[model samples]
Every structure is written in C-alpha cells, then in structure tokens.
Target: MAVPRVLILRAPGTNCDEETAFAFEAAGAVTERVHVNRLIENPKLAEDFQVLCLPGGFSYGDDIAAGRILASQLDRHLGDMVRQFCDQDRLVLGICNGFQVLMRLGVLTSGVRETQPATLTWNDHGRFEDRWVHLAVDKTKTPCVFLKGIDKMYLPIAHAEGKFVTADAEALKAFGDAGRLALRYTAADAGQASDEVLPFPSNPNGSEANVAGICDATGRLFGLMPHPERHIDPTHHPQWTRRAQQPQWGEGFAIFKNAVDYFGE
Candidate 1:
C-alpha cells in the first residue's frame, strides 16, 4: 500500500494546523495544510489525500459561534465534495474547534436526521475551561479507525463551548445504543468507565453522558474536543518527569498511528 496522505484543513483563526500536521507526519503519514479558501476554489483538491482533518483553533474569531461560519462555507460551497470524501474508503477527524465545525456541519452525526441531532454548546459553568482530562473509549460500540488500539488517553482541552449535548433523551440513548457515543470523560482513578456523568473537573465541560468525543455510524468519521495533537510526545504530559516510567510516546500518539495504520490494512 502507498503512504497515507493526510489533509489538514484550516480556516481563518485556525491555529493548531501546524501541530496537527506534525503529529500526522510523525506517525508515518504525509500531510499538507490546506486553507478553506483553496478547497472551496477547487474541491477536487480533497481527492489527493486519504485522510481529512480539521484541527483546533478559534476559527473566524468564534463569532456567531465557534465553527458556524466555516461550517456554513462547507455546507454551501463544498457540501457535495465533503459528502463524497466521507463516502469513499477514507477517514475524517475533527479536533477542538474542528470538532465544533464537524458538529455544526452535521458530519459527525450523519444519517441521523435532516438536522443535527447533537451539538457542542456552552460549558456548563458558562466559562472557558482549559485543563488536562482523562478520556475512556468504547471499543465495543464503535469501529472508529483512529481509536482502534486506544483504551484511554490523557489529553488537554481548551474550549468554552466544548460540551456535547443531544437533542433529547431518546437521541442520546439511540446514539449510545448504536455505538456512536465513542468517547467519554472519566475520573483519572476510575477503574471501569460508566455512563454516569462525572462531576466538575473530572467531566470538565459537564457534557451530557460525559461525552468528550463521538463517531458516526460508519465510525470512519470522528470528532472530539480534546487536543490530541498537543500530546503526541511523552514530554507533552504535564508531569512526565514525575512518572515512574516514561513511555516511548504519549497516549495520544496512538490515535494518529492508528489512522496511518488503517491504510496499511
């Protein structure tokens, strides 16, 4: 198989593209940082890559909402192209603000309804929160390619509207039942993860059902609020020096590695 090429999509105010590109390249994949204008001008540019990633940042100055403007641009100008890209044997990932974009674009929850069934809203505390969080994955529920070998991750999250909420209880249950609820925030010392929502720092944003990330029915598309790209190296951890053992890589590195490995299979 050929080397997997990743497209790191960026828009105005998108600050995390470089870090995201570096993570992908380090994971043995080729990467290119493409601006939204360039893609809108020529949607065919998407065909050159096997992976599409929307990295973090305060896109459009977070006006009207974090990713609303960019999402509208894609919906109005490049909707069909994006749909085709997802329909093919490829993968899509959205991190931080990128996840907000995917949520607004309705790509992460595709096929659920004509309108988005879930959304990332304001933090329950009504303030921006920036902190390290422990995330647990639901391996049995989702076939998400990026999370193939990841059981848990310690990642940093910086956002004000990173809370995940479904339209209703029925929708939440439906997504959980179908395995679309792929990741959740959990206590650092928690032995086995549960659906019960954890308290303030543990759950961070107070997201419903403790959701920190989610995937689509196909599991090829994923969106998460935490910045995995920020933690690809062991030193990225806040307390690497105090650890009893330092691993070769950070917990988040597995995500990029898994994405690259998917092409090999």
Candidate 2:
C-alpha cells in the first residue's frame, strides 16, 4: 500500500506549516506545504492531496478577528472547492487559527447562523496562553477517524481565543453523548477524569464543557484549539525531568498517523 498524501496549508503570517508537515511526514505520510495563494491560483492542486490541514498561526495578522479575513477570502475564491472536498468525505482539520477559519466558513455545522450549533469564540485568561494540555478520547463516533481508540493524550495549545462556544447546547450534548468530542484539557497530575470539569491547561482556554477538540456530524471534519503538531516529540515537553520514568509518547503524531492509516486501510 502507498503512503497517504497530506496537504498542509500555508498562508501569510502563518508560521507553523513546516513543523506540521514534519509531524505528518513522520507519521508515515507524504506531506506537502502548499501556499494558499497558489492553491487559489490553481484550485486543482487540492485534488492531489487526500488530507487538508490548516496549521496553527496568526494568519492575516488576526486582523478584525481571528481567521476572519482569510476565511472571507477562501469563501469568496475557493468556496466551491472546499464544499467539494467536504462532499467527497475528505478529511479537513483546522488547528488554532485554522479552527477559527473553519468556524468562520460556517461549515462546523449543517446550517449557517450567527449562533450556530458548531463553533464559537472563547477568551483566554486576559492574554495569549501557551502550554501543554491532556485530553481524553471519545470512542463512539466513527466519523472521528483521527481519534479512533485514543482514550487520551497530551497536546500543546497556544492561543488567546481558544474557548469553544456554541448556540446549540442540545446538539453539543448530543456530540458528547455520541462520543464525538475527541479531546479535552486536563491537569498535569492526570487526576481529572473525562466526566468532571476540565482543570486549567487541561481545558486550556476554559472552553465550554472543557472541550479541546471536536468533529462534525460525519466526524471527518475536526477542529481543535490545541497544537498537536508541537508535541510530536518528548523533547518538546517542558518538564524533561519527569521524562525518565514516563517517556512522552509524542501523542500529537497520532492525529496524523490515524489519518494516514484510515486512508491506507
């Protein structure tokens, strides 16, 4: 079987595309860093990539609002292409600003309204918060191909607006009940379970219900505020002192590994 080809998007001011690509490549996939402008210029380029990723960064300088302008540009220029990808059941992910872009695209849920059931903006503790967070796995949802069988893992998060808010509380509950909530923030001690309130760094931005990551109804589309690409190695951890007994398994790579394996399977 051949390795999967993943496309990591690169937009102006976005700085993490390289590391994101490295993570996916390390996960046994052939990765490419494609510039957003070139993608727009040649829309067919998207067809070559099986998985699409919008890596974390300050795109468009986060002007007006995070991912607003870039989202608008994509909506105006590449809307059909994006819709086509989604219709084909292809995997789409937005991490941090990428999450902001997906929310703005109005694809988080089935409908489009100012207050949709899918995505929301959340304020951090006054300023940008950057650190590691622990998350639990939701096993019920099949559409969540990336997190299949993952009970929990540690991923890094860096953002000011990382909270996930939604208008459809009931729908949100349904996702949780269905096990679509892929990850949640937790404490360093690993004392908190999935049912309880997610502690700081665990639910980094204090997201509603302590959600660190989520997927669409199909589970193919995923978005998270945490930076999984940052934790692809144990060395990325700040507390290397604790590394002796428990070597960090580099959980972030699982996201990419799962994607590749899903397509290969």
Q: Best by lDDT, which number? A: 1
Worst lDDT run of 10 residues, candidate 1, spans: 188-197
Compare the candidates by TM-score and give the number of the best one: 1
Residue by residue across 232-260, what tens digits does model 1's lDDT show?
Answer: 99999999999999999888889999899
Model 2, residue 2: C-alpha shift (Å): 2.7
lDDT of 2 by residue, 140-227 (tens): 4435888876767777778887777666768667667665566676666663336456656556676777777777777788888888
Steric clash pairs (candidate 2):
137-151, 143-219, 185-202, 185-203, 186-202
Give the alpha-carbon lDDT of every model: 0.90, 0.77
Q: TM-score of each candidate?
A: 0.97, 0.90
**What's model 2's overall lDDT?**
0.77
Residue 125 alpha-carbon offset, candidate 1, angstroms: 0.6
